[model samples]
Target: MVRNHSEDRTESIILPDGKIDLFLFLDDGVNFEIFIGGICNKPIVKHPFPKSVMFAISFYPMAAEYVFKRSFSDFLNKKIILPPGYMGFYREDMQNFEGFYRKACVTMQRIVTDPIDTRKVKLFDLINRSKGETKVEAIASEIGWSSREINRYFRKWLGITLKTYIDIIKFCNSLKQVKSGHFYPELSYADQSHFIRTVKKFSGTRPTVLGKNENDRFIQLTTLSDD
Candidate 1:
């Protein structure tokens, strides 16, 4: 979860990070609104409330299906208002950060009692293990499914093409290296030019600018701490 105390802002670009987010907006320490965010294939410009507190839960790709109990394609590149009672007991503790987190975990644990899709789980593991360089055909072969079938599953569950998801994973890995002040040429891209282009495509900024961005720091910190 992430808590942001906004002062004043007009618009900002939200870069793709290959995950779904659920946001709970609090205004004057009261529950104001709730939204469910989906996978973003490209950078998006958003205008948020100038002065408000925001708490967001960034769900991993594999956990989204269990948490929402729906296909991600329904919310691709969009934010939908959560239905009333969807948060269960968590709604009562929205004002307390720690209490809210505990309640959220309980809600998730209860909902995720159902079995997960093993093929999708394995596909995510394959991408992470290969650092997003795994071949699509290889995944299909291992999962005993045709490439077309695998692509369909990816589109429905991830809200993006398989290739785009791979690119996002690769970009995230490369970003970690960049933030740590170490770029290994052989591990990430074909060349420095390729790296710059890929970063700009997803993040709408050059590597240097991205490295210095506070939003990027928040995303990295929250993502790492989530586990």
Candidate 2:
């Protein structure tokens, strides 16, 4: 029998973006995403547990070494992103996940073109190296993309800025730990407060309030902001 225990599910959906992500796989940092297409049903990215179940057709492991110095957006939103821009190609069909992951992979790979940039190829490896310590300058320098271009690629791919995406990753990880009774809690409930504040600041809710509580559902943070 398979013993089951809940752990952090590495995933997030950014508000107003056409991407939903399944983070932390294929490598420690790089994961997958399903693009939101009004005309296309993209793939559903998958994580380990309580996650939407989907079969992943693995891209060739050798594909991981591909590096890219340019951004993914040269063709992405411009409607020029080729299907082979990213993955090495595998077709996964899963009725359970409604084909979310497969469609996303196909869509992402659609952006590929000849002479793939070695810098962009490194994005996958960089994600693995990030480990919560990645800095904007470093990311910008490594792939030879400017900070602005990198932000555009991140915004296009992950549906959020790199820093924001990282925050969401950290928050969701801590959340999983808390739910599984593995989180370190301060006697003063400092974790809860910080979690709530951070969520409220970014997600516009208390941390424990999301997903599990209907009331936790909230309007986007920008609507509540003082800008």
Candidates' TM-scores?
Answer: 0.83, 0.40
Candidate 1 stretches greater than 4 Å from native: 4-6, 48-51, 89-91, 181-186, 214-227
Which regions of candidate 2 are displaced past 4 Å? 1-115, 155-159, 182-195, 201-204, 209-227
Best by lDDT: 1
Global CA lDDT of candidate 2, please? 0.39
CA shift at 162, candidate 2, in angstroms?
A: 2.6
Per-residue accuracy of model 2 over 1-227 as CA lDDT, tens digit each: 01113344544322322222222112221333322121101212222443333233223112411222233322322222224223342223223244545565575566444566566668546754453346677777887888898677665643446665444444433444333434353222346556566555544444455434242122222122332
lDDT tens digits, residue span 1-227, model 1: 44446665545567787889988876656557778888987777766554566678888788988887789786778888875465663355566888878878888888887788888888888888888777788888887778898778778887688888888888877766666555444454779888888888987877777766565432452254322
Kindly provide the TM-score of model 2 when superposed on the true structure, using C-alpha atoms. 0.40
RMSD values, in order shown: 3.1, 12.5
Best prediction by TM-score:
1
